[model samples]
Target: MIEIDSRAFGNKIKNIRNSKHFSLRQVSNQSKDETGVAISPSYWSLVERGKRNIPKPQTLKRIAKGLRVDESDVFRMAGLEAPTEATNLTRITSSEMVSVPIIGEIACGEPITAIENVSGHMLLPNNLVKGGDYFILKCIGKSMEPTIMNDSNVLVRAQPDVENGQIAAVLLDDDTTATLKRIKKTKNSVILMPDNPDFEPIVLNEDKPGRIIGVVKMEMKMF
Candidate 1:
């Protein structure tokens, strides 16, 4: 049993949970229903935030089952090797998938209304999208490169706000245009930071007219 850093392990679990688009309540409910284990959301939150060590093996198995990921993978993420039998655990599959519309292209430069046109649709795994109204936008500039490249399709969850340091699709100048950028907030202004250092950050007054259209949840690269 390799020792795992509680904080690092917790962050890994948090990232996986978010990528799966699962809420703490959902995980807890599902785990209880499926595995007969009742892990509270508060305890899970503590586990995810590094306030607690990894749970016991049985509890970890229940958690893995609840998250719909391989038990072995969960153990591995915690810096422990799974028993040989655990490696053979079956994969989890959801009965339904979510369909997200691929909207028009969004400018990583001057900002364009990317949702004005519908290009096509994408079928995403139910676990990947959960329950939000999601849309896809094609990237049109290199300013967000190395993370969101030009021509890549980005999945955005329809929301009006995002936490600081999260990427969002922002509607600017009276909803006429939109851009994809990482959001940072100061007391006086909202800063749109580009991933590529070559691009300068765009700062708007806190009382600016722009609104957050949605948060960039995930990106799909175009081959």
Candidate 2:
């Protein structure tokens, strides 16, 4: 991570908050991480006054959402490197945007990104997303709220599996059901854990089975 002027970052945040007419408590209460921890009002004040430390990526995202701004723009202000730029492209406002297919229902036996599976396409100006074959897959449930919203289409990088603690697009019931959840692997089983505590984790074993088709690179533009 790059060291940045805390005051400069704080000023940028304060100005945004003021522009939105949001108080410290309002932003703090409106913001929360995926784990459901909100930034405290006291800490928020300290941040605005340049007396506290910079927030993590997740915290910045929540705060930006509370401020009704793009989190990538906040990241740029803080001099933090995240996949906030370029990928935020909705319709390629710039000169370059690669068209990625939007995969609908699973064809089961057919190729993952086959034409039979594509329902639509999304244009994006992203070198990161261009690094691999990508498709848009909708997260069908509320399991990943505060990170990936319910029924939100996510940009997916085509891959067979992912490391532990990474969110993946997984197919269940022989590819008839599609869902998004964080994956955890053990010697005996594959565990699909939900970010929300309101939902229960799914443990797949001999009786229950699933196949990971891809990992979510980012949330696609909601349009």
Candidate 3:
């Protein structure tokens, strides 16, 4: 079995949280809401600061869920093998399947779509996502946690627009980065809402430069 250094593991967790812009309190709250586990902000802070040792398997699982990250990654960071469910989901038979391109990361700060972003491909079971053109993107932030999840691979169907309250991948004014958020349209503006309360809603004027790249059809958890 691989051995994980305690301090290194702690740093890893902290980095993941920072990348998602999730505060310790937010992670704790979301974990409790999603998994019925109560992890206090103080305790999580200790773990992140390397003052406390890594928790047990069950506790680690709760932390992973709370952070909207792969539980298996957490397990590995702690020098443990991932659970069967986490390890087995990606193994699919070739029959009745289609290859979906797994694009590079989509930034929440700005939105962009281009051919240079292609990273690799994933074979997905057919009937999972039905649409005109479909691709996959690795979610990079906690803004949509408890719904889309950070680091989760989301299946997107190419479309210019989506109904209100629907989640979509969008490009901001610069169109150099991309973000995934729930669309809320008003008379004068469009609001991108994050499922995590810690994040403030992004309001864009109706006339602002932006476009919906695609609607999220499905999510494939990565561990």
Candidate 4:
């Protein structure tokens, strides 16, 4: 196991938090907005001070996004080296960004799915999202092709609710599923429609059950 110095990690967290001019409350609030996950300000303060150890990977991703830096950058700040940048044919803006780790791929109604171990990630704007939590995923299949494509990396802002017409990471039943489809509201149901016509739409009884995990705030095409 790679041993990380707790004190050094804390100092690095503090440095990044201060550098971004974000207070403990600000960080907690941003996290709540972005991830729909509640993080106490006092607890966050301890985490920043390195008084807290063993931060979850998802939490790390969120903190990196909130601080406008990459997870590798955060690792480096904590005395670990940053990972090499992934190559993509698509044009990337010169502005700094951080890569959120790809947990896996998800589908709306497929019986089978692809659940890969932490294979790769998608890059996103450092400050565009407010939540201190996020993760990336490579979209597969044509169910949401064209706009999302078969191999596009999508940056998901982890939250429970999503706005209309935005791509989202969604969960159906008990599966860890994700879709690059747009959200639309009907009088009786919520429809998850695809950009392409080859696939059908997913209709949910809004007043009853269903999960719209989060919105896809950013994407990078690789094909």
**Best TM-score among the predictions, by candidate number:** 2
Candidate 3 residue spans exceeding 4 A from truth: 1-95, 105-114
Candidate 1 Cα misplacement greater than 4 A, ranges? 1-95, 105-116, 206-208
Per residue, candidate 4 scores C-alpha lDDT tens digits across 1-223 of 3678777777777887888777776566445323347467787778866788847665665566556566777665555454445531346575767666676544435322223435565566567545556776678777764345477676677777777777777676545555567889888888888876777988878444567767786654343
| Higher-TM-score candidate of 1 and 3 | 3
Candidate 2, residue 143: how far the Cα is off, in Å: 0.7
- TM-score for each predicted model, relative to the true structure: 0.51, 0.64, 0.56, 0.46
Question: Which lDDT values do the candidates have, in the order given?
Answer: 0.75, 0.79, 0.78, 0.64
lDDT, candidate 1, equals 0.75
Task: Tell me how far the alpha carbon of residue 89 in candidate 2 is from the true structure, in angstroms, after superposition.
Answer: 8.4
17-36: candidate 2 lDDT, tens digit per residue: 99877777667745754344
The sequence of per-residue lDDT tens digits that candidate 1 reaches over residues 7-81 is 998888888889988788767644542313567889989999999887877777767855868878888877777
Query: Pick by lDDT: which candidate is best?
Result: 2
Least accurate 10 contiguous residues by lDDT in model 3: 106-115
Worst 10 residues of 2 by lDDT: 84-93
lDDT of 1 at 93: 54
Runs in model 4 deviating more than 4 A are: 1-99, 105-117, 120-125, 128-131, 206-209, 221-223
